[model samples]
Target chain A: MKKIIFGIAFLIFFSFLIVSAINMRTFGEPAYSEMDDYFIENAQSETGANNVVTSVVFDYRGFDTLGEATVLFTAVVGVIALFRGVKK
Target chain B: MKEMSRIVKTVTNFVYGFIIIFGFYIIAHGHLTPGGGFQGGAVVGSAFALLLVSYGSLNSQKFLKKDILSLFEGFGLILFIVLGFSGLGITFFYNFLANSGGWFGNAAVIGVNPGNMNTGGVIPLMNIAVGLEVLSAFGVIVLTMASAAEFTKKKEKS
Candidate 1:
């Protein structure tokens, strides 16, 4: 009975995934790409970085990177706290 | 968490330095290349993991100081925050240094030519700060886990 239920659930999940994949938009052709176009065209002159992705990440979208750094720091703090008892 | 065999240790010694240097290269060249701080930091972190696995937790402690790593992590985060605030004269996270004719201020070629190393402004600095934080964080986590595992194993044996 459990195997039958599991198989049904698996099939349902995979069907959803397959449907989405089949209906996915074409690659490198986002519907809303005005911002992307701007960045690609002007990032070099504005940020002086050769890599547009890097400029977007570290310059234009710096807040997101800050949040990521905070999350990593918090995770490290948690790990250290968990293992505090083992330290001499 | 006993040390690996001599062959594994030898190989790690031979390779870890290069791995670390390559990671630094990625981080430093992040503005010009495909990688950035996080990707390069992960690469360096893997080298620390390699060191811990081959040398054992206890033996690795001499070099992988947890306190120093923690300090560096804190320092990196603080530096990033400070840099963010530095641009408040215009706005938060402003590119104040770009094209300023100062350090890292040279204008890049309009289109695709060879990338200049001295082109990125605050981006490179931020990359270094983030890279340092990530590498240290990885080292601390790996060291802590290895030691914890060793402690648990000893308790089990007893």
Candidate 2:
């Protein structure tokens, strides 16, 4: 019974993923607008980093970076605690 | 464990040094390049693994103890949070030293454009924090596994 429910969930997830991928293919090459040009031109200056993606991840979306780092820290602490064992 | 030849140990040591240097380079240039804290830390961790495999677990532990690694990990986390909070008034992770117009600013500068490197706000410092945490965490993982294995072996022996 559990296996059957899991199988259904997996099928639904895959179906949604496939539909999203197909929909992405239908969109034509996005037209380069002034914002795109600006991002390309001044990415280094504005973000203060050479790697554009790093700038995007850590600068423009700094809140997201904080969240991600917090998640990583939580996971690390969890793992360490798990290995260390619990004392009643 | 099987004993490796002297030639193999020498070669492996050379490779390990190369990997460690490359990882440091990646972490240092993280602001400028594709590689960053996670990638570089993994690389360094792999180099330690190579040392354990080629040399021995005992030798590996001599350099990096479990407690020391944990301390380093905690320190890195604290450093990251402190750096983040330092940007409170302006923005989260703001580079306070970016335009201080002092010797400290000049020393902290990176890239061909000194001022620009400082502009990334708290990104570089954050990268360093992440790198230290990752490297220490990975070392802890290896230590945990090795210790577990040793415990199992002792139990079997008894």
> Best-fitting candidate, measured by TM-score?
1
By summed lDDT, the worst window of 10 consecutive residues in model 1 chain A runs over A79-88
Question: In candidate 1 chain B, where is summed lDDT lowest over 10 consecutive residues?
Answer: B112-121
lDDT of 2 at B77: 79
The TM-score between candidate 2 and the true structure equals 0.75
Clashing residue pairs in candidate 2, if any? Answer: B95-B121
Candidate lDDT values, in order: 0.93, 0.70
Runs of candidate 2 with Cα error greater than 4 angstroms are A1-28, A31-38, A85-88, B1-7, B99-121
Task: Give the Å error, residue B149, model 2.
Answer: 1.4
**Per-prediction TM-score, please?**
0.91, 0.75
**Tens-place lDDT digits, model 2, residues B42-123:** 8988887777677665566677677888888888778878877887888877666543554223332333443334445466
List runs of model 1 lying over 4 Å from the truth: A1-24
Question: What digit string (tens of lDDT, one per residue) describes model 1 on residues B1-158?
Answer: 88999999999999999999999999999999999889999999999999999998889999889889989999999999998999999999998999888989999999988799898889999999999999999998998888899889988999
